[model samples]
Target: MSIINPALERPELIAYFLGANNYSWLHFRNGEKKLLSKPISYLEGRLPGFIRVHKTALINPDYVQSLHRPLRQKMAGKIQLQSGETFPVSRRRWNQVAQSLGEHLSPGNNEEPLQESVYLDDARPTSEQSNLGRSVASLFLVTSDEQNAFLARQVITKNWPDYRVETIPKSIHLPELLDDLAQSELPVLVFLDARSDTLERLQTLQRLKNDPRLCRVPVVLLALPTDKSVIEGYERQANSVITMKEGDMAFAQVIDRICQFWLKIAELPAHC
Candidate 1:
């Protein structure tokens, strides 16, 4: 698709895209611009892989420096730009975006060469699998620190032996991550840490839940204190919220619940 240049008619107009709502702004070189008032839905279909990471900017994955995963739902990783600007990657879109990055780096894509270690496990399963079921499931774990990320991976691998678990660093670019998620298959589950800020995280969750493409993907927020009021608020957008301090058995139980929930959704008879 061709890039939309509203400046064609108004030669002085500059174009800026925002992903928060998927709207673009047409600005004149003279510093005046009007919000296009178009729904992000339209742009989501036409824009290339990279998109607006926030309400005020568009990002290309090629330019991303790193992705940081925050430990709490409210605070996800900030996308570091080549220009030194930081953008937020909503917990909801983290997995999708990480998958997209892997694809981009895969052979035949424009991504740079992979390190030897990444190639060492080429034969490994890309998605998780199990004798318990036939379908493969993708899990995205959002953590605040490397230790948690490692722990989460260990838990997932031990319990859901057959599923593919993609652990995204919170420092990556949000737009790039979402682009990846957009291309993945159904039955994706995202685990968000609850220790982070809730307002921004909720906004991100709301956006992901609202997207028809990603709406079905379940989002489970991980809360430590396990406040009832907080849980209720997140439940509006999250599939479920489980406390990490609840011990290994409880953690496993929560994972099982999520697995069951997603499996049920995946098994629904298709209309198509």
Candidate 2:
């Protein structure tokens, strides 16, 4: 029973042993416990903002104390935890992990200062982009897996380029994240990954959709390959449903389409 302290910037979460895989077992944590019979890969896109620090650990950057790039050749850098547990950071994800932590520490520093541009693309109007410059869109993604959240961030960085992206794993409670989202003035987009069969996922979605306070903010359901058939059910409640294979282009297209729709509605003539 490892307990996370409150002084640490990371959220307090618990991990339940889901089952055993070849290398690692599945885990889910909130205030209480729930185990899964599935593999960790099945929860990849489902956990928001979490990253696989080691074969057995999915950690939220908030709880990370520091990154240790050891001089030893065989060992990669490790992410030190407040609990004193060091999770190995793979060579492939070193840069990405560092960048994500850097961005979190220094917000609004990555993008070029918003400047006036006369040039316009055929797909969107100059005024549209200009307006977008004036307003910021912060997409807060919630998934059950860190890798998938990073994937979403990569797609967003490649396509939107102008917006900011942050991810949190499902290990943190949905209510807590929603509270933070409500505090932010920017347009908040919540991407929920369909991973766990736990009632929390469905219950949270239902509550958010029905809550008048949160219903207007866009919520996207990221469906797994196996969950394709259930997407239609979510569409009625979610602003959009995105399948895993659709990739970045398709995901960006969906974001652009929704933004355009919102802009049109906002700019509508009073008489109409």
Candidate 3:
């Protein structure tokens, strides 16, 4: 018998797995996918926490937002994830899926679909773009450096036009920022630059993580390319630590990828 380390498994980070024949596609919370050579049977035996919802699908129970069943038995049921992606639940698997989501299921109108925006990949066509209904989320770039803020804005404007960028100085009062973010009616993400006041920035990051109201909001630390800086940022509970790169073009590319992943790919928590 093999014991899976909780740290290594990080099952919460995985959304589900879709398998066919000898291959499997691993979907993540960040909207990233990985093709594995192993079959579904192989993974089902090895992974402990995943619930086999369908012949081809294995979902992490933690990510299951709800189980949706139609009024009539005309079609199969669905397992809706917090990420707004839904997977089919065969008739045979309905009982099993419901039992697995016993306590976790949201206690609203089961017949009504979530008002929150659905991904384009959803079975029901809500919109042409992903997260269409809730695209006006605020993105905060906490940096004293004007150049860094300008570069991030350019990339965000070009990639995520719906996202609004707000530049905040690192020296701002932590409590004021937290209070403002806690009252926000939309999703929020923060980018902190540690190039200048690295210690002060890390302290601010720690404070954000410690606050329960705003802890779910993703905070990415922009640190110098050093082991110490990266390690410290993680220790302070930064969601992600990206190293600062030289030159405008190179850094802009990095910012582009950042915007793509956070604003577009990753499913953010409903802060409101």
Q: Best lDDT goes to which candidate?
A: 3
Which regions of candidate 1 are displaced past 4 Å? 1-18, 22-136, 169-184, 224-235, 244-272
lDDT of 3 by residue, 1-272 (tens): 13223312777778888775688888888898877777888888878668886677788888888777632222245667888766656545566666667766667713343222101111222221454445355576777666766776767766777665655554334433344322553247888888778888988788778877767878888888899999999999999999975433466577678878876789888665
Q: How well does model 3 score by local distance difference test?
A: 0.65
Q: What range of 10 consecutive residues in model 3 has the weakest lDDT sum?
A: 116-125
Off by over 4 Å in 2: 1-135, 181-186, 196-198, 225-232, 245-272
lDDT of the candidates, in the order given: 0.49, 0.47, 0.65
**Model 2 agreement with the true structure over 1-272: per-residue lDDT tens digits:** 13222212233453322223522343223334334444545443345566654344566665566664432222235555555544445544555656666644434322221111110011221223444535445555665555555555666666565665555454223442343232343245666665453345556677677766666666667665556436643744876665554333355455455545544454422211
Q: Mark the 10 consecutive residues where model 1 has the least summed lDDT.
A: 113-122
Please provide TM-scores, in order, for all candidate models, with all chains considered together: 0.48, 0.40, 0.47
lDDT per residue, candidate 1, 89-154, as tens digits?
544555555555554343433233221110001122323333334544456665544555555566
